[model samples]
Target chain A: MTILFLILAVLAIVGASAAMAFRSAVHAILALALAFVSLAILYLSLDAQFVGFTQIIVYVGAVAILAVFAIMMTRSDSAHHHTEVFSKSWLTGLVLAGGVFTVLAWAVLGDKTQHAAADAPAPVTTVTQIGEALMQRYAFPLEIMGLLLTAALIGAVVLAMPLLSNKSGAKSVTKGDAR
Target chain B: MTPLNGYLLLAAFLFSIGLAGALTRRNAILVLAGIELMLNAANLNFIAFWRYGTHPEALTGTMFAIFSISIAAAEAAVGLGLILAVYRHFKTTDLDEIDSLKG
Candidate 1:
């Protein structure tokens, strides 16, 4: 199990890095999907089946699709036609990323091993436990999240309205010109 | 068999890559992808700590991960909406060129 997890973890990191490095939006999103899948596998190895499923459903299923749709909807033929231009800030990005990685790596490893020699207590997490915890301990935050989603939905509708009206105006103008 | 350190290292690497993408990408959508990567990296850390850390009963990390995912979704929705609006106005998605808002 540990070996499987190690491999998956490596795959996830490599896939995510590749996704970040790619210039093509479509390819980058595809790599992200791969990374999400690998993370879901990692979650399973950790014995969090519910979380793993949620990760796949939310990240891979919904978010990935939404990203692809957004790219397709907004991207022009010219945008997709041009060769990708490498950014001048690539070196700076690499340096900052390297610094963060080194710091986090040190901190994570610096901590003493807390688990004893005894076999890890079997993971006791369940859907019911998580549900109860959310309702009892996290109900307020959950309600807040609902409000946030509602606000986002309304905002999206409002933002799209102008485009819709413009299209309608263009249609009417064409009709008047034909007459 | 993988040790706890292995997962930790992986998470760190993923986070850094995401950070790099966020910094280097000029496209707003790509930048959002980078941010998503960073969030997932944090989620990995949360699960790793839950599996290996001393506090067994504290399911705080998992709960936080769930909340973060929800927020990420909401962020993506609003961001894409804004991107679409910008594209409609300018007929392009290049961040560098969308400078009319700067003044």
Candidate 2:
């Protein structure tokens, strides 16, 4: 189990880095998908069966596809689209991220409390239990989540709608009018 | 048999990488991807704590992770939609070039 954990962790990290490093937008998105898959596996290893499958279905399935479609719609498909992959302040960002990591790692690993708290036996958190919890204890939040998703869907459609202006007291050309 | 600290460390590393990408990347979509990574790292931490915590029967961590995942999905949809809208207006997705609001 430890060996499996190590492999999955390494794979997840590699995929994440590759996602950031890849110059082509499509390649980066695909790498992100790989990372999401590995994370789902890690959740499975940790006995989170429902979260793992949801990760696969929602993230790898829906989110990745949404990103790809957004990329395609934006017409940013060419590999040579950007001459530079990163911004001018790339070093600053790296340093900031490194500093954050150092602090977090120190706090996590330097304390004995974490290790002391690590010995609990893995709980068998089956999907049925999660379902019951969601339907019973979490029903209100579940309904709120549905409302949020609906709002997001409507907002996305409104935002992505083609820009059409009719304020000049004249019917503008409905299609192929260059902005 | 991985320790809790191991998971915590991995989550930290992943979150850092995501931050770096979000800060440095020029493409808006990649920036969104970075945010997704960070969100996933947080989810991993939640699951890890749930698995290793004293009262796993409470199912708080697992439930929170599930909700976080749902929120992340909604965020991605809206974010990419906004990116598409921005691209239409600017004809480019480069973060550096979309500096019209820069004073």
Candidate 3:
């Protein structure tokens, strides 16, 4: 179990690093997908079977594909000519991230309760129980989620759709032609 | 067996990587991918806590993870749509190039 967790952790970290390191946009997105898959596997190893499966279906399946489509749609011929992949302030980002990690790791490692809490056995969590809880205890939030998703879907379409109003329509057409 | 702190450390590491990627990447889509990675890391933390925390029968962490995942999906959709719109207006996906808002 420890070995599997280590492998998945390494895979997730490697994939995330590759996503950042790759220059090509498509390759970077693909690497992100790999990271997402490894994270889902980690969820499974944590005995979160439902969440793991949902991660595969939602993240690996939907979000990655959506990103790929967005990339394809936004493609410009000049995109390939870019010299640098990372931003100019990359060192700042790296230093900040490293600092955050160090602080978090120190807090986690120093926590005395975590070591004492290891005596509890892993509890069983089945999908049926989760489903029941969702339908009973979490029904309100579930409905709200459905509403939020619908709103997001509509909002995305509106945001991406071309401006078709009489005043902006011609301008939008000219912009399309320029691209 | 790996202890809870091990998972917490891993989550922290992943979160940091995602933060670095989001801040340092040039492409807007890649930036969004970094955000997704950060969200996943948080989800991992939630599951880790659920697995190891007391009162597992309440399944609070699991429920939080599920809701968070759904919210993240919505966030991704809206963010990508915004990216698409910005791409249309600017004709480029480079982060530095889209600096009209900079005062």
Candidate 4:
């Protein structure tokens, strides 16, 4: 199990770094997909079957497809498209991310987290228990999430509808004038 | 048999990579991808803690991860739609060039 975990973690880390380092946006996205796929495997190994499947279906399937569509739609053939990998503030970003990682590593590797982990009992978290808890114990948050999803979808449609309608309206006016 | 710290350290690395990408990338779509990575890293942390915490049978972490995944999907949809609008107005997806609102 440890060996499997190590391989998956290494694969995910490689994919993530590749995504950050790639110049082409398409290549970055492919690398990101690889990272997410390995992450789903990690979830499965961690005994999170439901979460693992959902990660593949929702993130890998839907979110990545949307990102690809967005990229294709906004593709620029200009010479500067390749240079979008970074900006002047990248050094600041590097420092900030590095600091955050250092703090997190120190905390996780500390004795407190180790003792906490050692105290935990064995678990048998299955999908049925999660389903029951979702409805019975955690119903409120689920309902709120449903509402949030609905609101976001409506907002997306509203945000995109105007430009679309304006184009169709222009076409209709020209056709009417011709008629 | 991997230690909890091992998973936590991995999560930290993933999150930092995501943070760097989100902070530095000029493409809005790539920024969104970075945010997804950050979210996934958080999900991994949650599952790790749930598996290794004192009350592993509580089902909180997995449930939280499921909710997070759903929220991430919604966020991606909305963010992409906004990016589409920005692209239509600006004719480019480069974040550096879309500075008309820089007041």
Best by lDDT: 2
Error of 3 at A153 (Å): 0.4
At residue A128, give the lDDT of candidate 4: 84
- Docking quality level of the chain pair in candidate 4: medium
**Over the stretch A1-179, how does candidate 3's per-residue lDDT look in tens digits?**
37888888899899999987888878887888898999899888777899999999999999999988998898832347855788899999999999999999988877776332655666788889999999999999999999999999999998988764446478868776676
Q: What ranges in model 2 sit over 4 Å off? A: A114-120, A164-176
Q: What ranges in model 1 sit over 4 Å off? A: A76-79, A113-118, A163-179
Model 2, global lDDT = 0.89
Candidate 3 residue spans exceeding 4 A from truth: A76-79, A114-120, A165-179
Each prediction's whole-model lDDT (CA):
0.79, 0.89, 0.87, 0.84
Model 2: per-residue Cα lDDT over A68-144, one tens digit each: 99889887654866368899999999999999999999899676653334445678777789899999999999999
Tens-digit per-residue lDDT, B1-103, candidate 3: 2478788988999899999999998888888888988999899999988888877889999999999999999999999999988987788888988899732
What is the fnat value (0 to 1) for candidate 3?
0.77
> What's the best-to-worst order under TM-score?
2, 3, 4, 1
Question: Could you arrange the candidates by lDDT from highest to lowest?
Answer: 2, 3, 4, 1
B-chain TM-score, every candidate?
A: 0.86, 0.95, 0.95, 0.94
TM-score of 4: 0.89
lDDT of 4 by residue, A29-81 (tens): 88999999999999998778889999999988998888888888878422344
TM-score of each candidate structure, all chains considered together: 0.87, 0.93, 0.92, 0.89
Task: Supply the TM-score for candidate 1.
Answer: 0.87
Worst lDDT 10-window in candidate 1 chain A: A76-85
